[model samples]
Target: MKELTKQQSKVLACVEVYLNKTGFPPTRAEICKELGFKSPNAAEMHLRALEKKGYISIQSGSSRGISIVKSQQAFEKNVNQMPVIGLVAAGSPTLAEENIEKRIPCDPSMFSDSFDYFLKVKGLSMIDAGIHEDDLVAIKKTIDVKNGDLVVVRLEDEVTLKYFKKNNHNLELIPANKDFSTIEVDLREQEAFIEGKSVGLIRTH
Candidate 1:
């Protein structure tokens, strides 16, 4: 099984504790109250990371959607092919047919974590972080990821890659290069969704 980072472990523990106490998984709001997070989004970020690591499985369309995997074998990656997404359009899903540049046979074990698809890097906002133009980044689709992780995010249908940092009700999309400025989003007013976390990068150039 892939080792979880310190924060990831804490989130897992939080989920376990809530399950033991309430006889069901905790809602994101409950996690915020327990974990001292300023917003539900913070709790969600950690939950998504836990789910991606295979320690838990999240049932969509539920407020308290977390469930334990309970088996090491559940962590095994079995992806067959990975879709390469390019230029995601507004109001379109990330993996929409028109956005898919190509499909490549990708070995599951090639990356540290299981990925949903590859997003072709288009710009230099994260150049200092070693991600360059035309790089194919392994993206694990999730809304919640640890702060400072490289994240693919969508704001009002515009997709971009940046370091994610959340504080209270405001989240910052930080650029790695000096040429670019960090984008600040107010969760109260602006809706920014985290599309995925970058687990690996494939550079052909």
Candidate 2:
């Protein structure tokens, strides 16, 4: 295998990251904007170098036509793949096997800790935290959490993402946005369990 130059390695990393997030290769203009290149020609040159080194396949005259070659295995070893479970409502298990939609590959080194899985956010309740609808939120599997920590909670049969708060005998699931009401569950009457803590988030433009 041929070793990559610094610029070629950076371009390859960008391509892999884009492919993992969007399931498609980025355009030359997109690469230029991402790498702060003055022009698309710079991005083109880097892409050509990557292809020449057998790291990627580039289809001419096609937008977003780049594809990873067999050499990508080296890069794959550095990433962590996690399942993207479907939307968790207000009363169910977020990690239910049936709710698993697909798996997403991401660079775990970008985060401070290891994550158990990814959840596709489905509402505006956490918009203030920069978590929007359809964003992929990385969750760490742990029930040990502190007050005001964003967590995935199972309230009866439903599940929700909110800031957790314990008040004497009650549990409060606070939403980041004021438009959404805070959920207060009486621990004596209903069971509220912490599913996991949100560690990081991924959004695609």
lDDT of 1 at 172: 97
lDDT for model 2 comes to: 0.80
Judged by whole-model lDDT over C-alpha atoms, candidate 1 comes out at 0.79
Off by over 4 Å in 1: 1-78
Candidate no. 2 TM-score? 0.58
RMSD for each of the candidates: 16.9, 13.3
Question: Model 1: how far is 116 from its true place, Å?
Answer: 0.6
Residues 31-88 of candidate 2 have per-residue lDDT tens digits of 9999999899999999998888766889898989898873343445434545688665
The models' CA-based lDDT, in order, is 0.79, 0.80
Worst ten-residue run, lDDT, model 2? 70-79
Spell out the clash pairs found in candidate 1: 45-144
What's the true lDDT of residue 18 in model 1? 72
The local lDDT score (0 to 100) that residue 6 gets in candidate 2 is: 85
